[model samples]
Target: MILADTSVWIDHMRRREPELVRQLQTGNVVMHPMVLGELACGNISNRSEHLRDWGLLPRVEEAAHEEVLSLIESRQFMGRGMGFVDMHLLCAAIGHGVQLWTRDVQLRAASVECGVSFTETA
Candidate 1:
């Protein structure tokens, strides 16, 4: 399973990246609430259609809310441009033991720092 960050989803929506599309087709991608919320709040013209498509994907079962607070309290990611949503996504990936696919440099760095598996490709 792969937890794709908001950046990746946004890029995929705009570009229809081949690899990402392939992953989605194969049902290898999983969704996080925060990522979904971010995308929902974006300026996508076909928002309902996009949400419906994403809604078909499985959602991460573990709740990362507390972990997100802990991560913020730890201050480890401080000044690294890591936000609550980023940490939440990282926690979801870590908890699920899934690869985090993202294009955000800061999120990639945080994943490395936290020793979570990640992929920048698609």
Candidate 2:
């Protein structure tokens, strides 16, 4: 299973690239609540439609606030600014035991440092 990150979703939603379209069409993409929240920040209102289009319901997970906080602190200590959404997504990925699919280099690097599995593409 793969946790589709907001960046890739945004690219798929706005650009409709054939590659992203094909990847998402494969029925392997899943999402967390944080990704839904980010999508909500955009113009999307039909949550069901997005979920259907993405091929999975939100894979809900318990809040790992402490671990997420630790990750944020570590990233800050290492000079990266507070990446709140990225940390939340990472927390969700860790909880779900799935690889995070994101194009954000910093988040990918931080995921490595935190021992979270992640990938740049679907």
State each model's CA lDDT, in order: 0.80, 0.68
Off by over 4 Å in 1: 62-64, 73-75, 120-122
| lDDT tens per residue, model 2, 3-121 | 76888878876777565555557755566877777786787647678756554554746457787787566656335653677788877777777777777877777667656654444
Candidate 1, 6-72: lDDT as tens digits: 8888887788778778778898899988888899988997888989988889999655577778776
Error of 1 at 98 (Å): 1.1
Q: Report the Cα lDDT for candidate 2.
A: 0.68
Error (Å) of candidate 1 at residue 8 is 0.7
What overall lDDT, based on C-alpha atoms, would model 1 receive against the true structure?
0.80
Error of 1 at 71 (Å): 3.0
Error of 1 at 78 (Å): 1.9
Off by over 4 Å in 2: 17-26, 45-48, 51-58, 74-78, 114-122
> In terms of TM-score, which candidate is strongest?
1
